[model samples]
Target: MYVCPEGHMAYKKARSLQKNSIKNEKLIFFFDVEKCKCCPLEGICHKIGTKSKTYTLTIKSNLHQEQLDFENSDAFREKSRMRYRIEQKNSELKNRYGLKKSMSNGLFGMTIQSASTVFIANMRKIIREIEKKGA
Candidate 1:
């Protein structure tokens, strides 16, 4: 939530959430700009003639600002990109390959079930790659 300079409680226009890093994070909140038109502090809040007015509030504590700064670095984006790809594969395993539940009851049964499920999934991927290469 945000408050205008004139003391009006602002309504959100949009919100963005970041993956938390050692901090309780509410990444960004965009205040509704339409309400700004009639606001007494409109001129102070934004330029006199612009159609768009945006105000953002980020809820991470100052103590974690260093972590936020690191998230903006190139290394973080690269790591996030790699994580996204693997997460997709993990999702496919659970959803399409039935890796979400064990087919058998005991530990050995669970292990073999898991191994065979992964093996089948890998074989399908290998076949697809070979097909693509041959084509």
Candidate 2:
């Protein structure tokens, strides 16, 4: 059983396997859309007179499900603190190192600029550590 984006109950219509070169087996879940048409929130959830209403969800195999479970676990919340720190670092880089505005054009130039900015940020961190130790 799967719920629609608008909280409408949708029954499972079909399930199939999708082959990919990445070695990850993808499972496709097809949900019926017939119930969606009669939903009270149909005006908000979907446009009127829309045809072929169906929802499909593509998920990976056991490993991906494990990952999903972990993401919802309390351990993942603690791990996500690191993500907040990383986001702060990114914000600092963008604000202080002119990363928000590109200094060069094209993909290669952008890569060089990003690498240099990160290198400078790391160097600054190292310098701050050294200064603290010296003090």
Best by TM-score: 2
Q: Tell me, by lDDT, which candidate is best.
A: 1
What are the per-residue Cα lDDT tens digits for candidate 2 across 35-117?
66777777676667776555556656688789899999999999897798889989999999989998888999999999999
TM-score of each: 0.44, 0.45
lDDT of each: 0.77, 0.76
lDDT of 1: 0.77
Show the colliding residue pairs in model 1.
none
User: In model 1, which range of ten residues has the least summed lDDT?
Assistant: 21-30
Off-target runs (Cα >4 Å) in candidate 2 are 1-79
> Lowest summed lDDT over 10 consecutive residues: which window, candidate 2?
23-32
Looking at model 2, residue 16 earns an lDDT score of 56
For candidate 2, what is the lDDT? 0.76
